[model samples]
Target: MFGVAGRISPGPIGFDVTMIAVDQPTVARHGLTIVADHTLGDAPDLDLVIVPGGITDAVERDDRVLAWLRDRARTPTIASVCTGAFVLAEAGLLTDQRVTTHWDDVDALRERFPALDVVDGPRWVRSGHVFTSAGISAGIDLALHLVGVLGGPDLAVETAHRMDYAWTPTIPEAPEGPQRGT
Candidate 1:
């Protein structure tokens, strides 16, 4: 809801979010099969890509998915929700970068990807074009931050207001490295 529906001030603060999958009739970790708007093969070019976390073992090892993420490495922004950071790290996109994931997966992510400087407290962390969130709800905060960056702070505030979310609009600083926006 950080896009068109979030427009309260009406100043061009809208993003066209699309759901893409490596294959159709994709089943989530909870066994909920979802029909995506596009598959990787025919997906249109996007300015931002947000990968949601789950039981991501299969997708993390899929060559097609990795290749697609690598190809989209130059996209303005690439973000992850919770364990999705593992997939990005697997694709070699988060080397030497500070990132975060779900609280429960923090140690595992740190162990699996030694190259990443995984921090534990931040709801979300941003290093250059890559953004990673702590867990499910943190993704919403990150998306709102993205809206603030892409659109404007006012729009982000309006979105939070409309959603009745207690959005602080403040981003936590990474332990090290530059936090650049898209």
Candidate 2:
């Protein structure tokens, strides 16, 4: 399965692997299972690709995974969590498309990837085939959105309500999070 790099904590000088399981209460309630991997290089045929945020490092620029993501986009729907949007941005997938990312990464992400039409707000955002979220916890929100979109609003709502999470908005929310960002 394709996965994004992540860290549990962002600190003064360093951090640890924040790679987390792509689990959603709603998804789980539906008997879903999401595996965790360090990179997206393994899956050759993916129905969907998900990237999550963390530190900005060499891996983010890894041509191997980037190329893999680029190539995979032709078949499966692609998505990101938080700053993972940066990965897709670098791969040149966000061009001329409206997308959302973790509030903290918005400015720099926008400046770094001018082609992307980045918007502010919401715990999660979906533009066309590319889905993005606010932050770590927001990943769950993004997943629910996908469930809603792919499974139907009723399913989405049921999933959200089942998970005890709030429903996503049709429009995006204003960005809000930590003090530091792009």
Candidate 3:
């Protein structure tokens, strides 16, 4: 997810991206060892903070990560991809805001954070400075949207074209009512 966001920037968007983690030598769920470029304590105050979702149960339990998220939420534009919304919700950041997570986790998110207005099917949804995307591929869509927000529609389109990605400028409305099996 960070890779997607990072790639979008410093091209036409002109954003300086950084990868930070709560700890160094971070091992991702897929067993990828991510040597974080910055630790939470060492990261500069950010204009944007992106939380990429994976292993939500583990992340939601990390008080230190939640604390950092809570602090950063006050200033930067915070975003979450997939189950990362759970992390933001755990940090008390998603209360009463419309959000979406991966389709598979939407019910869990709503059950866990009843205060959150959890929407189900948009590729991504934005409420104020916080944005949440549905799943993995949707993160790229959200990143493109952010580029549109920060840069401009033309730049976003250009960036998309440069990457050979078919970017959708507008997200369709999610269907209303309980999803199947809910």
Candidate 4:
């Protein structure tokens, strides 16, 4: 999704993305080995921080990662994909906020973070500067939404078009709670 943002015509959307990890040579759940660009201590200040979802039980237990997230909470935007919401909640960043996760794990998120308003259905939810999305593909939608917010609607549309993705322009509005983001 972000690849589309960095490869648009006329000019690329300006974003210098960095991948950080608690440790180098991290292996994903599916046996994918990822060599991170930086460790938490070495990462530069970021305007936006995105936490990806997968098997996060281990991450939820890592105090170092949680502490790093807490320290980076002052970033302009913090987002999570799927069950990555659990990590954010564990770090106390989702307190008193409405959030979402993979539909299969919605109950778990609600149970674990009783203080949060765990809503289901929306492809993504944006409360204040924190954003949460449902499942893997929803992260793409959230990414596009962020591109629209950080860049422009037109740029987002163009990026979507370039990627051949059917992008939805509006965020679903819930009957109660804050207005869904544009």
The top-ranked prediction according to TM-score is 4
Q: Per-candidate TM vs. native?
A: 0.89, 0.65, 0.85, 0.90
Backbone atom clashes (below 3 Å) for every candidate: 0, 8, 0, 0
Q: Please give the RMSD to the true structure for each candidate, in Å.
A: 4.1, 13.4, 7.8, 4.9
**1-182: candidate 1 lDDT, tens digit per residue:** 45533445475434666889988988887699999999999998877888889889998999999999999998878899999999999888889899999999999998998988999999899988799999999999998887777766777787788888898896433312212222
Worst 10 residues of 4 by lDDT: 173-182
**Candidate number with greatest lDDT:** 4
Model 2 agreement with the true structure over 1-182: per-residue lDDT tens digits: 01111111122211122232322221222455555443343443545567767764554777776787778675435678888888887777777788778887889878987877788887766666567787877887676555444434444465566556765534333322221111
List model 4 lDDT by residue over 1-182, tens digit each: 66567556245346666899999888988899999889998988777789999999999999999999999887877899999999999998999888999999999988888999999999999988899999998999988888777766777788888889898865423322211111
Model 3 stretches astray by more than 4 angstroms: 1-13, 171-182
Model 2 spans with C-alpha error above 4 angstroms: 1-41, 168-182
After TM-score superposition, the amount by which residue 175's alpha carbon in candidate 4 deviates from its true location, in angstroms, is: 24
Report the error of model 4 at residue 9, Å: 6.2
Q: Candidate 1 vs candidate 4: which has greater lDDT?
A: 4
Q: After superposition, how far is residue 83 of candidate 4 from its true place, in Å?
A: 0.3
